[model samples]
Target chain A: MAKYAGYQSSINKAVFIYSPEQLDYKFSDTHPFNQKRLELTIDLLTSINALNPSNIVKPRNTTEEELLLGHDIRYINAVKMAGHGKLTEKQGEPFGIGTEDTPIFPNMHEASAKIVGATLTACDYVMQGLSEHALNLGGGLHHGFKGRASGFCIYNDSTVAIKYMQKKYNARVLYIDTDAHHGDGVQWSFYDEPNVCTVSIHETGRYLFPGTGTITERGSGKGYGTSFNFPIDAFTEDESFLEVYTTALREITDHFKPDVILSQNGADAHYLDPLTHLYGTMNIYKEIPKLAHELAHKYCDGKWVAVGGGGYDIWRVVPRAWSFIWMEMTDQALPTGNLPKAWLDKWQKESPVTLIPTWTDPENLYDPIPRKTEITEKNQQILEKALLPIRSKNSELI
Target chain B: MLIEEIMKTKIFTLKSDNTIKDALRIMRANKIRHLPIVNDENNLVGLLTERDLKNALPSPLVKKTVENIYEQNLEKLMITNPIVCHPLDFVEETALIFYENRIGCLPVVSGGKLVGIVTTNDLLYTYIEITGATRPSSQIEIRVNDQAGTLHDVTKVFTKHHASILSVLVYPDSQHEEKRILSIRVKVMNPLPIIDDLRKEGFDVLWPNMPGINRL
Candidate 1:
């Protein structure tokens, strides 16, 4: 593997925060949000020799006290009861479980707590200078609310991790999410805080689940101008997706200049992802982490923490897309040509669909979008609106 | 929903003789746009809005004016005998009145007295809540024949799955005049099973019937 572009070849610049227990946060075998993506991604990294065994860190279970940072006491108690099969479907309904979305599963509380702790572990590694960057692929449950779970998210790891950073380190954190769906839980968590800045670029709420990420949702009260949402139109391809992503992220980061950066990397925006309508390919994933690496070094002294979010195409899309972040963070060049034949040969049999055995997706992922011109224009308009507060503030200083 | 249920009852009123400055102060302090002018007996006389004040006052670019418009009498600017609604009036009718009259607010009156005020913002928020976009839910759309019992037929599938329906709306299909599109937002994120059930029931479940669902 070649060293990444314009980066020093450090032995361990980032840590792989994971434990097999994170896989226990499963809903069901047929559920779209599968932790099997985590296994595939780890294998891809390991096969390329990009993931260092010395840097892999096992996570601890989140203390009930830490879970309290981002959840209601009653919700936590209810989750505990439901985990042991003591809570009934009727009792779990009000808490957003046992529904078609998040049906009750065994040991859900223990599993969710481990994911939360993994995110916090990554945060601690970066904020405490133990590592320059960290990746917790099990975290990024962005739809979990204060008391309810939605969108297959049980306990919002990113929300708890951000609050933990604030309370423990007193660090001004910047959260960046590029999932196909809106990061509603994390956005609303710090909607009124001035210190934490959240930026989400997703398919517009008009056609996505948990629809509430309009540009008008800028942080309220003193937190005004801190929250930014770039809800691009559906069927947005890689070029347009990267346009809004790179521009908004750079502008928002330049304005906020936080002490640390936390990115929620959800690969569901891929063209093959059955859940989302976005047409992003592996191209956007390459730039997604490259830019995060550049900005973390530029602003936060390489203090970056990333977590996984909503990606349904675990077999065909998520493995390749998520592996880019580790490669970028570890200063390893994006693998080209065929993936390690051994990795593909092993996983292909288990994969329901054929894997793209190469570094790049096919030239023609889908038919050209008819509304490409109009969608790009509408996305540009949203980008301008989302940047208005920062632009005006910049002009005021001038 | 009725006017009284969602209307802001913490009334802010000013006497008819009050100056434009008084109205501006009240609106600025409370961040309200509409204010009702009441008589001594608390009967609604006129209404004043931020827009009317803006029109009456000189522009900020105009540094000097011979007469200060802020001190002008409210009687000269307030809309006299402004359209009002009853406290018991349906919100939908009030919304229609708002659209038909091209007005921003309607003062709720009962027995010929000022009760409360409802604004365009309030009505829009009510609709937002009714649409269930405020909650975390996944939406699905199905195209069905433009006939009665179609909605019932579609909802039966959702009922069998015990999926809580947040909101259900009927929209006209743009290309097919003989068909109607039924949009439903359900509380569950994994709407796959319900969508599958709808499709098996012979309804064309659009999954995400939107600007991009059929285009690409």
Candidate 2:
């Protein structure tokens, strides 16, 4: 725990940073990375009475100066021009706009900036000691690059927010990403920064987009041992996913000893996620934020900021998965059994697929994977190999 | 790719008159194993390697050290007539040369001047790129009959999806003589739609395959 743990009366447990403006960062009607997820998640939270006016804080638009901390000026300008239908395909191609993955949409710049600003707003509340933690459902654009956008992400909110925390509070920030894809943008942003350690556990890039985040990609130069990646095998089920996630997060937090924890809580590893092959279920979601909250209290004096990332199957998967993050944040008893009747009743018409109807996924979501044992052994080996450096270093200290 | 494209252009050289110690220091500083011994006109004269340096010096097993071995001229230990390749040679050709000669690198020469060097690591990286493993893409393997237009049929599915094809590698299938395995990498997060189209086209999708498990 931090020395500031003694402050009790002034700091709130957590603040929910969001606004409807965040829903405008859409690519198209059928794009996979949807901001409607933000609405569905907020609606579920509100139905359960987890959200209120006191806890809800609207997001602001991050300035060009703030966006530049994690983006190139030219790329930022290109996004701005592309947002207003001014940039051509040829010109926007260099900036990773006007493509099938991230096609240009009107007000793209304003939408992306608002997401960055929401994350920054979350950071300020936490770092200013006004809130112990914050959640920005529109943030966690992890694949957005410094000079280009890829994988449907525009401006990387996590990277920009980490930079903001460093510059504003001069604090050592630890970023934890649970997205199905690599958090390449934020990982590369601080690949050589010793103070800002990043830990990402995602599906192996063997067949995933942004084929990076291998176990060998430790930080380089003076920042060696700061970056940790656990690229688990595809079709990895809930048991194996939680094993690697909890073990790696515990080891990395102990090794880095950061002052704050910024977690990118992408809900795309579920079995229903159309983009990824990980076979995670609602169990992982409940535990993901639960552990993040515990570790923040243990190491950071509860200074944790959570952000949303890739989660397709918006109807059945995202709402229930994302609600756990807020429920965990406010110290609500983790819900199980049937979901609120009104919440599911309101959104079932909007959802294309039949909703799961319960707080948890049904038993035996899929047929048992034939190679579960081998996959578990392989993932366990990956965890050991990824932690070898820190383990050896700690042993040397002893 | 040509040797000129992938080869390291910065040549680290040692003269024939330079001492073995100078060769060793250059190798140690650059973290290189092979040193191109050159002349005043920048022509490749010989090749000196760390193995040769190790062979010349006294072994650690022996208590007495041969201190003066470091002072010996590099020409005595270097291979005076090392095989070289032209800049225009294909990387595959150079790879064959290294394999046939059992060497680790090739000295790329043009117009009687040592222009660059190609190491095993460089060739290996080219192979990785050829497999399209370096890019942010997903690979799908298809078993196709080794007939003309078979590749065209398989490629049309990706094109229909507007999925950028990074690289395609064709290899022989061990099970069937007339069949070939086509490994293709495409830049898309959700390849499910593309895979469905390929199956509908009657192409055998061998990968992203979970045979017994149910899929949505």
Candidate 3:
């Protein structure tokens, strides 16, 4: 238990990242992603008296210079001028502000910048050693790229944070992403960088949308053997999820010895999520921050910054899962007690058709993943192929 | 009911190069009093406790560095052989070991390797009664291609036998990729053997416990 102190106190030091400006960031009314989701979490924490204003920090906007750290300069300029305006040309496809997934609402640039700002603030807290842990639920836009945006994400907060940590602190960073979808944007940006060890465990790209987390996509040049991907089959549950993550995390963290860990926590992998087939519930989501916090403390003297990603079941699941994240960060786990009457009353008024569960569903419905299955075997082979050059090389320049 | 339900997966371990002070820091962080020291190979070497650290410290006047403290022959401070267990250790026996030795934790092992560690807290967490101790008298065995939800059919058979399973363990058959052997222990009120009853119900009862299997 003494080894847990690194995490215990670190988890206690988390600063909840938010901004009143988050209300301007809604994508569409048809989509479940909106500002009220964050408000619900704040309300829940406030009602439970877990909300400490001292621990809350408003997000900071990234300057165009910092934005250029991972993004194209032209892209930044386009976003600034667009300002909730739509982009229709295929050349502007990467800047997904005009598409169906990413609509150009009013204050589009400002709202996206706030999300990036929240994550950037989280990174600053960890980098400066002011706080060992911080979380921004509005970030984790893992699918964004340097010149383009895809998958309902605009700015790649994780990539920007990584660049900031590297450029500012000169510290070795281990970026572990736990979002359901592939961390394609983050991966592509650091695919050739050595100082950053990227390990992503997600549902196999096959049989899933935007499928890209194949095992064979290991980094090239000096960054060989630095990128690791564990693409598990669809419908994976809690136990198997834990197994794969534990194995990957233990090995990768030992190999990397990171100075700070930036994790993209996406709650969309929950069984209730409409988009994914993975079956983890609130328990798994809750367990992750605790483990990540523990591991960060153990490996990196408790330096960690967690950002929220893709979770669409706003009223029913996202708020609850992230609240558990808040609870984990505070070192006070949310109990099985009934949801506060006031919160539930407000939740019903917010979403009329959704059924709010009183307690966390116990079943993760997990089973062992077959290592020898054709799909897994094929994926392992592909990953091995991608990582072969890395394994053979000695050092990768970041 | 079984140790599998209540074992901690993360264990507290120290590398050899780490000082006794370092070990103590880890122990304090985890709120644990014990640490299992391992070499680079992850092989267990010795155990250190808070008592060892206290004893190793010198008098107040002689301010010594941590390296100097270790150089003062503190090698003799650790407990050499600590008790360990497999992940599948029975809960009753594990609890007995804790009581008998007055130890709070048992480092779980698999294939002579450290897979996880289970403490009293883990035992307590697993003891939450979601359902009563339902034991099965009928031992049903089957061979089929191992796939997800393969046990669903066998679970259905147990439901028909009016059996409540107390514990279940799966062991893979060495020669077959498609086959796995599962043993289900169930709780039954009647002394009458249900092995034959399950066999009559078309289950392949290859291995049945002899009458009077130890309950505790």
C-alpha local distance difference test of each model? 0.88, 0.88, 0.69
TM-score of 1: 0.93
lDDT of 3 by residue, A34-107 (tens): 66778887887888787778678878887777778878877876676666355444445446555545656666
User: What interface RMSD, in Å and to 1 decimal, does model 3 have?
Assistant: 23.0
Compose the digit string of candidate 1's lDDT tens values, residues B1-216. 899999988989988788888898899999988889999999999998889888988888988874767677899788998889998999998899999989898899999888898999999889878875888777888888998888889889988988888888888999899998888887776677787777788888786555554742
Better of 1 and 3 by DockQ: 1
Q: Could you tell me the lDDT of residue A38 within candidate 3?
A: 82
Q: Which should have the higher TM-score, number 1 or number 2? A: 1
lDDT of 2 by residue, A1-398 (tens): 22345764566888899888888998889887788888888888888888877788887778989999999999999999999889997799878788778899999999899999999999998999988999998889998989998888989999999999999999999999999999988999999999999999999887787788998899999888999999999899999999999999998999899999999989999998888889999999999999999999999999999999989889889989999999899899878889889988898888888889899999988888888898899999999999999999999998
True-contact fraction in model 2 equals: 0.48
What is candidate 1's lDDT per residue for A286-350, written digit by digit as tens?
Answer: 99999999999999999999999989989889999999999899888888899999998999898
- Residue lDDT tens for model 2, B30-112: 89999998999998999998898889988889999778888989878999898999889998878998998899877888998
TM-score for chain A, candidates 1 onward in order: 0.97, 0.97, 0.87
Better lDDT candidate (1, 3)? 1
